[model samples]
Target chain A: MEQYFVNKVIENNRFVIEDSETFKHVAKVLRHKPGDVIYLVDPEQNLFTATIERITDDKIETSVNKLATPSTELPIDVTIACSLSKKDKIEWITQKSTELGAKKIIFFSSKYSIMTWKKNVIEKKLIRLQEIAKNAAQQSKRRIVPQVVYVNKLTDLVDHKAQSNLVAYEESAKQGEISLLAQTLNQNPNSILCAFGPEGGFAPDEINFLNKSDFLSVGLGPRIMRAETAPMYFLSVLSYKYELTVK
Target chain B: MEQYFVNKVIENNRFVIEDSETFKHVAKVLRHKPGDVIYLVDPEQNLFTATIERITDDKIETSVNKLATPSTELPIDVTIACSLSKKDKIEWITQKSTELGAKKIIFFSSKYSIMTWKKNVIEKKLIRLQEIAKNAAQQSKRRIVPQVVYVNKLTDLVDHKAQSNLVAYEESAKQGEISLLAQTLNQNPNSILCAFGPEGGFAPDEINFLNKSDFLSVGLGPRIMRAETAPMYFLSVLSYKYELTVK
Candidate 1:
């Protein structure tokens, strides 16, 4: 079944999708006619199997067939906060991480980060990343699209509290500190926020600040992963630990 | 410390670096002179710390100071055989998987694979992919560079046997089957071969053939990962299970 993310909230067994992009995708691209069954995901991540009752110039009228349960969402919410890097690599991370079940993604400027987003460019970048996340979520059959947020500094992440907080530091890997991530996750944290450094990695001051702010510095493994690869590895391990190993 | 993969096998506490790529990297790029210390990785995945004694137009002579131990190599050998996909995506997989500790990578034509390698293009493709693996290995400080192989059919995998053979299947994920990969890995297999499908995934006939040929189907997680993402997920999970969690 075709799936879409709609902006409207589901109420009284029906909802109106007035977004022009979705309207064009359903009406023009897919050519979905009245009575075609499509899965619509609401803002709250609730999935509904709806039948298209009618299509209009500005809206899609859908009647709810039933509420559908999707197991694609991860059991725990994971937010990956990474320092901004090259443009294409960040876009790739947004797309791939969404498919791997990250609940939210936050990009911020780090002390060693080479890329910086201007205030005017931030909105455009977020819009592009959000689109990538939405398309990847729909393709992966995820009920909710991970939101992409931009933070101006690493210290801003201190406000994004979670049950478990970790920073992937390469120095920890060098010291052979293993199982901290697994041990932390073993406590059954309902939400996780994992931070990764930029191309050159986190500066000493950034690490000191994160260390003081209660962010547990964890290692991915012995090998040094590229900045873009670390978050994907983290999310994959989360899946294996929570979804695969526990059962 | 500079690292270079030398073609010469170490013997009698010395070896000559003759490969032009390694020669250019050490002699021209880094401008290393006599008495400089360089780490050389041989074909056997052994690391040798050597002092550069002389540099000539043809070769650089180095005397081994001592054998160094690099634990970047995984405990167990893993080979990822993926159905050939888009050119850049396959190249990306080769590089990333190598960094994540894959010992070998095999590319094959699948039933639903859109891209096919002609006989004439195979050698060039292999060379390109081999270069990618080599660079990634050096960047990740891996002891060994993964070998790239090409196969024509799924049945050809029988000759590349391992103690454990598994296929990443999306259907198994949809059915919520878990722990098979971790269980198989727990048996302490010295070598493992994991196969992933192309964008369209494996056809029913291909899955049936794999099922009959001792390849256990394993699911990564609930969400549908892209073809490129599945192999990385497999490698990350392997690292987490074998390297991190057990310790």
Candidate 2:
């Protein structure tokens, strides 16, 4: 069953899906007939079982009934701030991070970043990435789509810091800095954010700036993960620590 | 620093890079001079720093010296038995699984597998996937490359079972089964293997068969992950439990 995020909430047992894009998807693409059921998520983050009553010229008239589905959002909010990479890598990071329960996916330009978004193309790229995040969230059956963001400089990350901020440092893992990530999670911060560098890695001054901004340098593990792989690692660990494990 | 896996044990202080592929990579592609250094892993999984002594016609002579770099292999052996998916998904799974410390990557045909390996193309596909594993292993600086395997039937997974066998079942998670993944990890099993279903998921008969074969169905979380994303989640959680967390 496909789920769509509606722009408005259902006030009564009757609802109409009027968005042209969604109408085309539900009516034309899937070729769904009357009596077929789909999921609808409202702006208030509530899920409803929408059974198609009739297909009109522009609206999908549905009988809206709320269902007691378990929330798919993570208890501890997680933000993954990644340095800008190539087109495919960033798109992959966005899609996978959304599935792994990130609340916000932040991409920033770092010293060693491979491709930085130009001033004019930033809006179009963000719209495309936001579309990817929405599709992935829907595919994963998440309650809310994770917000995608971009920061122009490493210094901009300070404004979006969480209670527990971290920078994945490979050198620290090489030196056997293993316990900090676990210890930080043990503290049970309500929200946390982690930053990952590009293929060439962050410059020394960039790391220093983040460190001074209260972002602790943490090591994921012994093996070195690629720039895109590390964010997925962080998000999965978050889900395991908060959702899977018994607290 | 680049790393190459040699086919034989480096017995003495001097070694020659004889493999034609590695020779092409080091001598022709990278164009290394007499003083350039690279890391080499022998069949015994020993790490050695090889400094170039001379670059001959078909081989590169190097002085081998042992290095005290700590092992990057995970504490617990892991095997991921994923249902065969599209070419891109399986290739992505192989590369990421190697980076995350999977000892064996198994692909089996399930009732709902999207693509089944033909009798002819199996060998060629496995070779290409194995090459991906080797490259990812070298990139992530692992001591050993993960071996890729394929099975004609789901029952073949029994021959490759580990001490702890699990199948990621979505129904189990929907029933609110939590704490099993954590408790299983806490048991300190020496080896574990988990199977994942395809896009449409496993058929009921396949699940029943696996259940009868001592494969416990485990829920990842509340969210529904794609077939490819679930294995990465499993591998990342293993890395966190065995490598990052205090055990």
Candidate 3:
């Protein structure tokens, strides 16, 4: 079934979706005639099964049949704090990370980051990234679109109230460290923060700062992964260990 | 350090590379001056630390320093047989799957694969994808480039001799089944062949053919993934398990 995110409240037997853009998409683009079935998520985050009752140029109305169960959200909140890359790579990070069930994506311009987003370009760039997140969310049937944020430096990564914080480093792989991913699944931590580096990678001082902040240094594997692809690897492993393996 | 794949036989403390392309890459494109370091692999599949000794338009020569130990390739060779997608997505899969250590990539047209290569165009298309795999191999520093092969039908796939064969199905996800990825570590299968559907996914009869051919049905998760993205997920999970966790 085609799913749409609707900004409305689902009451006893009706959904009131009044967002103009969504109304236009549902009524005009979709060409959803009356009595056609569609899935909608209301403002309260309830997924409602509804049949189109009326189609108009302004608003398309649907009668709520029942609330759908089985939300596709990850069991634990995961916040991937990755160093910013060039525009296309960052967009890829946002899209794939959302599909793998990231709860938040925080970007920091690292000491060795080659690409810089000027202050003037920040707003429009963020809006574009957010659109990528929205489309990924809808495609993956995610209840929430992960938030995208930006930071200027290492110190800008303030301590969040996460149950665990990890930094994936190439050095750890050289040392043959076992994966911390499988071990971090205890009670499915309230929130997990994973940080990745940019092209030139984190400077030695940045690693020192992260070490001081009690971030566990772990290894993904032996072969080197590109900057944009590494964090997605981390999230996939984490998701596999926690979400897929558990009974 | 930059790495390049070289085919040479080290004899009497010297190395000779006969491939004309590699000669041009080293002596021409890289503009090697004597005493520069390059990682080379000999015909015995052994990694060698070679220092540039001579540079010529036809042949660049290097003196062998010592036998370098290559990281043991993944114990289980994994081959991903999937339908080709849009150019970028297919390139993404080829690059990332190489990093994840996939051994071979095969593509076949399905009922709904968006892109199609006709008989006249097959060789050129294969060459293009092979170049992708070669660049990916160089980027990830793999000992060999994964082969890119084209096969046209399910019957062609049934002739493979991998120890394990499987296919990812969204219907399995709908049924709340665990992924075949979870079996990677426990089973320690010697080689794996995994097939993924095209954009519209496998028709019911196609799924039945795979089932009848003894391909295990695996589910990724609740959320749907693009066909190209799905195999990378499988390989990433495999790396997490075998490369990081098991050893």
Candidate 4:
């Protein structure tokens, strides 16, 4: 069934989708008619059941069926923090990470980052990335669209709180450290943040700062992965380790 | 240090890089000056220490110092037989899979695949994907480039012998089954072949075909992944399970 996230909870036995974009999608693109089933997730993370009854140019009216209890969110809130990559590549990461159950996508400008968008372009870029996250969320039937944020300095990361933190580093690969990621998996914290570097990678000084912040270091593998691919590799493997393997 | 693969074995104190791409990369792009160090890997999988002695637009000269043995080629040759996805997405998978050490990439047409290129377009697409594999191999410091091939039928797969065979299926997910990927890793065979579907995914009849061919079915995870992302997720987690976790 097609899924959409609505900010308001179900009232009575029906939910109204008045948002223009979602209304157009459910009513126009999907061409859902009366009696067709669809899912609506409200702000409280509660899933509402609805059957399309009436479609207007501005609103989609659906008769409520019942509430849903299943959730696609991971037990832990994962936030991927790294320098912004090229536009297309960042979008790729956003989509895949959303599907993998990320709660937030944070971008920073590292000392060695290859490309940095102008300050004025950041908002537009972020909006586009958020769209990617939204689509991926709907495709994966996720209840939430991970937020995308921008940070300009290391202090920004230091200010954020997560129960556990880790950075995937090539130097860590050289050192043969496997337990950093494994230990994080073992701890199973309320939230975890995994960070990656940009094209030129984090400078030695940057890694030192991360180290001071108590960010554990992890290694992906022997082979050197490109900047964009590393995060996907990390998240996918992490998901497999905790979600699939344990159950 | 930057790394380049060379053809000749380092004997006593000398090695030669004769491949055109390696030559151009070392001689032209890098403008490697004498006394500058570059890592070289030979066909025997022996990495070496080499220093540039001469530099020219069309050629470069280097002398070997010592043999270094840093390699991650799996004991088994793993081939991924999948349907072609969108151009950029498939290219991304090619690059990441090469880094994860897949030996061969094969594209087959599945009954429900969304995009199918014509015979004339196949060769060009394959070549482009091959280039991605090559660059990924170099970027990851891989000694060999994984070969990319295209086939028209599932019958062709049965003809290729491998110690183990498997297919990833969404049905397995629906059944609440664990991924066979971990089990496949445990086999640690000389080689394995894994297959994945395109965007629309494999038909039920196609799954029957794979079953008859002795391909065990597995689920990647509960959440659905895009066609290109599935193979990368499988290979990365496999590499982690075998290469990283074990040793």
Candidate 5:
């Protein structure tokens, strides 16, 4: 069954989709006519099995059967605060991270970051990234679509509070500082904020600031991952530790 | 410091670079002069800090200063046997998996695989992937560059023996089969062979074959990952379990 994210709320066990894009995708592209079954994911991440009842010129009416139980979301909320890299790499990271169960993604400018988001076109870029996240979420059967946020500086992440904070620092791996992330996740924090650097990595001042702010510097492994590969690795390890390792 | 993988072996504390690509990169791109230091990783995965002694028209001579310890290779060997995906995705997998410490990558044809490799061009493609692995290994400062191998079918992997074998099955994930991968890794298998499907996933027959061959069907997480992302996730999880989480 095909799945589509809708913006409307279900009322009296029925909901009408008025969005032109989704309507076209269902009624035109997928050719989902009356009596066809499809899944509708609401804003709250609740999935419903819906059967198409009627179709109008600009809208589609579907009868909600029941709520589905299986969730594709991770047990713990993970927010990736990564330094904005080159254009293609950032988009790739957004798509892959969404598939790996990231709850939120924030791209910020670091001391060594090369790309800077322009003020006037930042909204456009955000929209593109959000679309990528949505497509990836649907393809991966994720319950929630991750939000993509852009910030001007690393300090911007300080305002976004989480139960735990970590920075993917390569120096820690060089010094063989292992088990920090595992130990932190073992506490079962409701949410986690992980920060990654750009091509040149975080500057000394940035590391000091993160350290002072109680952000534990964690290492992915001994190998030096590219800027785009770090967050995906972080999410994968999180999934393995929190989801796969648990019985 | 920049690192390069050389084919020559060190003899009497000196080695001459003969490979055209490495020679050009060292002499033309880096513009290294006499007495400049560079790190060379040999075929044996040994890292040597060398000083440039002389630069001739054909080759550059360097005297080995000392050997470096603390390798970046994983404790256990991991081979990713992925169904041949699109050109870019397979290349991306090779590069990222190399950075994540995969010892070998084998691309084989699956029942649902979209792209098929031609026999005449397969060797060339393997060389290209090998070059990508080499570059990634150098960038990640890995001790060994992963070998890229090509095969015809899933059963071909039966010839490539490993202590542990796993297949990333989405159905297993949907069925909520967790802890299998962690349990297998906890046994500390000296080598592992993990296989991933193409976009459409494995055919039923392939799954049956894997099951009969004692390849455990493993779930990555609740979310579905792309073909390229699965191997990277597997390697990341392996690194976390065997390397990072170790005290």
Candidate 6:
């Protein structure tokens, strides 16, 4: 069953999907008719089974029944703070991060960043990335779609800090610093964030500033993944540590 | 500071890059003249530092010095076997899997596979994917370029079984089959391979055959990942378990 994120909270036993994007996807794209069943996640991160009762020109009315499933979100929030790259790479980071259980995705312009969203284009680009996150979240059956944010400067990442902050520094991995990431996850902070550098990686002063700002330098592994692949590695490890490795 | 895989072993303290691809990349693409240094991984999986001696008309000659750095490969060998997907998706899987330390990558035809290469095209497709694996492996500084394989049927997977074989089943995860994966990892299997289904997932009999063939149905996590994302998750978890999470 396809999952759609609805904007409004479901108060009654019924709901209507009025968003043109959702309506078009459910009605015209899939051509779902009355009696068809689709999953709906509300603003409150509640999953409901919506049985289509009527499909009008603009909206689909459905009878909703909240499912008893637990939230699929990770136990701890993980925000992947990455330096901006090309358009496709950042968009891919957003989509893959959402699917792998990122709570928030932030893109910042670092000293070595190849591209940064201009003041005029930031809003449009963010909106597009946000849409990609929503669709990926729905496809992955996530209750809440992750928010994607953009900042012009790398230092701005301080504002989005989680309970524990770390930067994925390649130098750390080169120095055989394999244990810090696991050690950090061992503490089990309420929420954690890991900042990934762009293809050129963080300049020395940038790493120094982040280190001073309390972002511990850590390594994902020894392999040098592309800028985009690094965050997916981080998110997947987070999932393995918190979600899958329950003994 | 790029890494290239040379087909021949480094004899004494000298090596020659005879491969046309590596020659062009070192000579024409990167334009590294004499005295520029590069890392080389030989056929024996040995790492060596090669100082450019001369860029000849055909091959680049370099004086090699073996580096004592430990291997970057995962302690336990892992292979990601996925049902054939679209061209872009499978290619992405190959590249990401290489970056995440997959020792082998296998693509097989399953019931719900969207497309399959005919015998004539199979060689060509595998070459493209293998090229992708090589580039990703070099970019990630892998000791070995993972071999990419193709099989016509799901049953062929039995021929490639490892110490612990797993099929990433959505039904398994939905049933809350969580502990088995970690448990299997705990056994310290010398080598492991996991098969991933296509977008539509494996057919009942396909799963049955794999199960009967001793392929355990393992759940990755709570959320549903797309066909390509699941293998990356699995490989990342393997790296976390074998490489990083040292007690």
Candidates 2 and 6, the one with greater DockQ? 2
lDDT tens digits, residues A110-160, model 2?
988878898999999999999999989988889999999999989999989
TM-score of chain B of 6: 0.98
lDDT of 6 by residue, A1-247 (tens): 9999988999889998899999999999999999999999989999999999999999899999999998899999999999998888888999999999999999999989888777999999999999999999999999999999887888889999999999999999999989999999989999998999999999999999999999999988889988998898889888888877875
Which residue runs of candidate 2 sit more than 4 Å off their true CA positions?
none
Error of 5 at A69 (Å): 2.0
Better of 3 and 5 by lDDT: 5
Residue-level lDDT of model 3, residues B144-225, one tens digit each, is: 7888888887558887647888888888987887746586447888899999999799888899988899888888877777
DockQ of each: 0.82, 0.85, 0.63, 0.61, 0.85, 0.83
Clashing pairs in 1: none
lDDT per residue, candidate 5, B3-81, as tens digits? 8888766656888888898889889988989899999888777889988999999798988855756888899999999
Candidate 2, CAPRI quality class derived from DockQ: high
Looking at model 4, the pairs that clash are none
Q: What are the TM-scores, per candidate, against the unseen true structure? A: 0.94, 0.99, 0.95, 0.93, 0.97, 0.99
> Where does candidate 4 stray beyond 4 Å?
A67-69, B8-12
What is each model's TM-score for chain A?
0.93, 0.98, 0.93, 0.94, 0.95, 0.98
Question: Considering only N, C-alpha and C atoms within 3 Å, which residue pairs clash in candidate 2?
Answer: none
Error of 6 at B36 (Å): 1.0
Q: State each model's C-alpha RMSD to the native.
A: 2.0, 0.8, 2.0, 2.2, 1.4, 1.0
Ranking by TM-score: 2, 6, 5, 3, 1, 4
Looking at candidate 3, what is the lDDT of residue B34? 86
Alpha-carbon runs more than 4 Å astray in model 6: none
> How does chain B score by TM in each prediction?
0.93, 0.98, 0.93, 0.90, 0.97, 0.98
Using DockQ, rank the candidates from best to worst: 5, 2, 6, 1, 3, 4
Reference contacts recovered by each candidate, as fractions? 0.82, 0.77, 0.55, 0.59, 0.86, 0.76
Quality of candidate 4 docking, DockQ:
0.61
lDDT of 4 by residue, B1-247 (tens): 7776666666667655667788888777777778888987766777777888876665667787765455657556889888766777677778878988899988888888766778888889889988888788877877787899888776687866478888888778656666466666777877888899987888898889888888999887767787887888878777777666664
